[model samples]
Target: MPAKRRPRRPADDSLAANLRFFAILMIAAILLRSLVAAPFSIPSESMLPRLLVGDYLFVAKWPYGWSRHSFPFSLAPIDGRIGGAVPARGDVIVFKTPGDNRTDYIKRLIGLPGDQVQIRGGRLILNGEPVPKLRVADFLDPVSPNSPCRPVPGLRIRLARAADGGAVCRYPRYRETLPGGRSYDVLDIGTTPADDTPVFVVPEDHYFLMGDNRDRSADSRFPAEPGGGIGYVPAENLVGRAMVTFFSTDGSAGWLMPWTWPGATRWNRIGEGF
Candidate 1:
């Protein structure tokens, strides 16, 4: 005799099956975002000349290993960190501020654990040797709604006209080479109190970070306080290393105007890698 066919599932059972499928998809997405890479948007010019406000980039999470901070809300069950590795000097990284331990701050890693870092006369001194700084052409930052070209506090504002007659902000930019020969641009607007500071020995399990925009950044040179400087961030607070810029805008696009979106996109900045 032929076997009997099974009864068809009810409509409610079918709906529950669909919901379960979606739940699995949500869990997969969360794991991917936490373990692989995640998108981050630049909100400040602290990393200017490389990263600009309105630029959206991918931050690779696996580079520095996995910690509670690597996951959303720092709720991951991991203790300390797993498979952690020391980041190279000059690697731009995103981490939680040691102050609040919740706010995200992105900066370049400068001093490793036990390394001494200081600023003298607007120059970076690492391990008692001055890092090479060469004068470069002024960075012509385009004036946009995102970048208003407003002068940094206590500095003079300089503006220029682009080839198309658009307003641009002229900044005194320089190229700084770290100890390991990693080179990047920096903006030194003028003399500031941070121009000179006592050497700070990076504590074990901590890293010293600074912004590429030297004069305007409140980094390890200042005390850890809410809404301000981030002092020697703990390694466990590391989130990820900036990988590449995927999207960018000039902050001129209105949600109501779909036609303006394409025009506002920063085409040249897309696909740029660190």
Candidate 2:
């Protein structure tokens, strides 16, 4: 009897097997970054003190559920894939800008759907009630060549004892009490153009946002006028909630010189949960 020939696997079968393995890995990475956590960088000081420029943060996507904004692109071409719970007040959220979906914004949720939000005499009023505010400290504007010439008012000089027992001139601190009793720090710049803005009622399905920096940030208080900020943002624009800071650097420092790395890196902010 002739020897039986051994069976052979087709080349197409080998190629298909490899492709399937690659596809699985890609899908797993996407799901992990989209549903669990992702990294975000702070490009501006809108949420200063709490978040600083150059601070790299980790945003949690599952806390409030996933929206169309949660996908790789702001718009969900395939619907019903991801959905999230309604965002709550006092939560620090990251979202796409209303008009331009390409831009991302991070702000504390001051108003929710159907809530009336307004800033009167520099105090936040929600649902026709004044949110309690207590002065904290003065905020000093860092010297920069391109910085504005405007000076912040109501800034009281205070002595802040440093770690080495040296005192520095610092502004007072303030606490903002939300309706649900959530309070956070706010810089007391006294009064600015943003303090006397008109009252705005948050439309249904939309939200009101304000920057922690108050006077310096261009947020929902003053849309993009000559020198204004973004106005109220819709719920659909929310991307995720800021969870914690993973890395940070002082804006004044640069990474050009290797010798400057030690001083430039904000080691204390590392591993600090926001």
Candidate 3:
């Protein structure tokens, strides 16, 4: 006698089970993105010579711990932040604007809690000492839809031709060495009102930030206003620390042109670590 076989699951029930499995998977993915790491895109030139427009990078969420700001739409239920850690100066961070608590801004952390920060004569002064600013080679940014050579008041937008015949925008770049020897390049486009500012004492649990593009950025130098400068950001507002550049484009790619995608990618900028 042949052994009896078990009845197969109903087709409707099987389909429902599969749907449930997929739903779980999607939720897991969303949780990972909200708590582990998430991708962020650079949409401005405030961090130029390092981060450029169209650059997509992953931000590690665990570095500064989790807060309501860490979750999408600031929906986390926990009060303040848990498992918090101190962020190092010179770490590029993403945070919610103090002005709105919704707008996200990325800038290099300059002044930590209880630190003094000021800008004078286009030089960064931290803790009453000047951060070394050494003149460096010009940053030859390729001109594209993403990076246009815009004219600044009282200054010319220097133009250059790349060896590959691409139009290039030349900006004076400098290397700044902060305390503890951490260093990075910055662009200084002549003088601006923000070049001089009174010393700012960072309050407890707050951090001061500034952009690499000294003259063009509306950072801590200005008063916090909606759709404008971000004042000192509270510790609870920190989102993540930038980890690596995953992808970049020159804004020349068109959705309708498949072949243009490859050529429009800024291959050299990808995989860059912060």
- lDDT value for candidate 2? 0.73
Q: Least accurate stretch of 10 residues (summed lDDT) in model 3? A: 151-160
Per-residue lDDT of model 2, residues 1-274, tens digit only: 9999877669878999899999999989888877788889987756866776777999998877777777787556544325567777888988888657667888888888777778888888888899999876555433222122243345544445555664444545688988777888876556777887677888887788888878667888877333346677866677788888888776545558778667667788788775
Looking at model 1, residue 147 earns an lDDT score of 86
Supply the global lDDT for candidate 3.
Answer: 0.91
| Model 2 alpha-carbon drift over 4 Å, by segment | 1-23, 78-82, 137-169, 224-228, 251-260
Candidate 3 per-residue lDDT over residues 97-168, each given as its tens digit:
899999888999999999999999999999999999999889999999999998766753588898899899
TM-score list, all predictions = 0.95, 0.78, 0.94
Write candidate 1's Cα lDDT for 182-205 as tens digits: 999999899989999999999999
Q: CA lDDT of each candidate?
A: 0.91, 0.73, 0.91
Ranking 1 against 2 by TM-score, winner: 1
On lDDT, who's better, 1 or 2?
1
RMSD for each of the candidates = 2.9, 5.0, 3.6
Error of 1 at 119 (Å): 0.3
